[model samples]
Target: MYMLVDCSNCRTPLQLPPGAKSIRCAICNAITLIAEPRAVAPPPASSYHHQQQYPPPAPWPSPYQTPGGPPPSAHGRKRALIVGISYKYSRHELKGCINDAKCMKYLLVNHFKFPESSILMLTEEETDPLRIPTKHNIRMAMYWLVQGCQQGDSLVFHYSGHGSQQRNYTGDEVDGYDETLCPLDFETQGMIVDDEINATIVRPLPRGVKLHAIIDACHSGTVLDLPFLCRMDRSGQYVWEDHRPRSGVWKGTSGGEVISFSGCDDDQTSADTSALSRVTSTGAMTYCFIQAIERGHAATYGSMLNSMRSTIRNDLGSGGGGGVVTSLITMLLTGGSLTGGFVQEPQLTACETFDVYAKPFSL
Candidate 1:
């Protein structure tokens, strides 16, 4: 006799002989035990077996323990890649991008205590041929960040430069636009579309790893393409909105703790300004971002968002687009309209909603 069973790893169904102790799934190639079927009918088809998705070669132990165990502390390896494109001398010359990249490196090293050597910096100023922010270099850097990542490892990717949108041929984007990152050689090497970004960075990520992205660029809200778009209210309530079902190879979440802080909405443009202190030029969103973290040290997601909005309103005018946010992001981030203010609203997108109140700002 034979019984139908789902692959323990990838969920593909297969037939198994009676009394078989175990079998390897041809689909995901995962070895799994053959257990008796449930006496009762299986739950709804929608029911999930998330653990089955993790194939053999059990993941490394997490750096953190449950609240019942040790106090909160980060362990394991940490790595980051900071990409800033000045686009100098090109038709799309951008000022302050190199500075943005350097500042981010500084923030991670000084504030987050990340080691300097572990972090990769790709900027226009770099004379090294391999370290330039060319399309190839950027992809390689992303690969470097995810490589050797273990449970509880921390990985970060920061891109401060130009972002553009193209017609979505794959139907992956509900808005019919595929957001792209313009490399220094984009005119020659082509743009890095969100699909490539997702596959390169988000797809291979294992559970228990932490990937944080700070994208200071135009149309960067979904740069990392996380599955869930979480929205919050002034009252400090949050709701997870499902990412739009799209065609082809990319979906946002990877079941890992992936989060992004983007400068603007898909239909909007972020600014490169030096208005904050008049001391140095940098991206407006970026300036407020570092400042908020520096001042608050540790604020809830809601508090951080509020602090950024308040800081920009009180200090600088809207950058690039001259408006606060596109209607899509305004509703998504604020759960309301832009009101009368004109300021670019930063966005936080994640794989899933966790304890927003408890998770600190820097993480």
Candidate 2:
């Protein structure tokens, strides 16, 4: 079958014929060899014993290896709990958020070396029937994230769903606290306040723990605002636009060793599509994110933020485009002290984006 291939050398997609062993892009002059899948017949029921006789070898390094005989204080191994809620009660398309979450889980497991057991997946089928990711599930997930994390541990919270915002409770016009995310069970009469979410999740995080939150929903652009936007002209780089600063607005917790990535500006609404397949439907921001991290562009948290912004800005365009509008923000808690005598470095290698258009798959 034909697969959409993005050239790591050129970062462009090319279409190839089905069953073709190799492909060469006419535009970029890049060549990619396709792997052919080998067919294997299923064993009969009586062959179960034969299969058991030749078990596969154990995976190496064991995702839970302690570096150099478990350092003092038993700094626990890094852990992650991924919650992906894609299917909405009122939506027609298959929620790609779930697919995005699963893809990240694969990256975390394979690339980041996070143990598979540490990553949790909460989909429509696995979600609790009684306590959906409504206010209840979000709260529970927060509890698990904050209380569950320990000093020297890093946690990542990625949410992909519909996000909405409202005026702050004080109702001060100049205050300008204009955006927030909407949970599964948000109602106009009773909205989920950002304060509640911060109080429950952000504020209570254990000291010395690094937290990274990625909110891939709408109305999240307020998470962080850049001082200005620059454009590269023939002469040089020039400042083109500046996001007007709004004073007296709440900027979440800044001194808590936490960073947030929001989806869109308060005035903008994120696009959720139904026509694209799950693997490819991840918002442009997320799609670019996977590409950047895998392609070795991002190493540190700060660097990751820069790469993410640049990719979204360049690939999706600034003002009007069919992509997710996302922003990244980081707040330090206690200025980051080494609580466990060991600092963990995030591991994210490089890989090209999986281009769907060139592939034979369809929605």
Candidate 1 collision pairs: 226-252, 227-252, 227-253, 324-343
Measured by lDDT, the strongest candidate is 1
Specify the highest-TM-score model's number: 1
How far does residue 92 in candidate 2 sit from its true spot (Å)? 7.5
Model 1: CA > 4 A from native: 1-75, 232-238, 246-254, 275-280, 318-342
lDDT of each: 0.67, 0.45
- Residue-wise lDDT of candidate 1 within 1-363, one digit each (tens)? 456566576544444667888766543457878854532222321222132333322221222323355554445667888999988887898766877787788778877878675687889788766678987678656656665466787898999999999897756676788789998988866788887687657766666788888899899878777776766554556777666545434354344578888887778788765423333356767766776776663477667766666655655553323333323222222321111233567777887776766777655
Q: Please count the clashing residue pairs in each candidate, in the order shown.
A: 4, 13
- Each model's TM-score, in the order given? 0.70, 0.54
TM-score of 1: 0.70
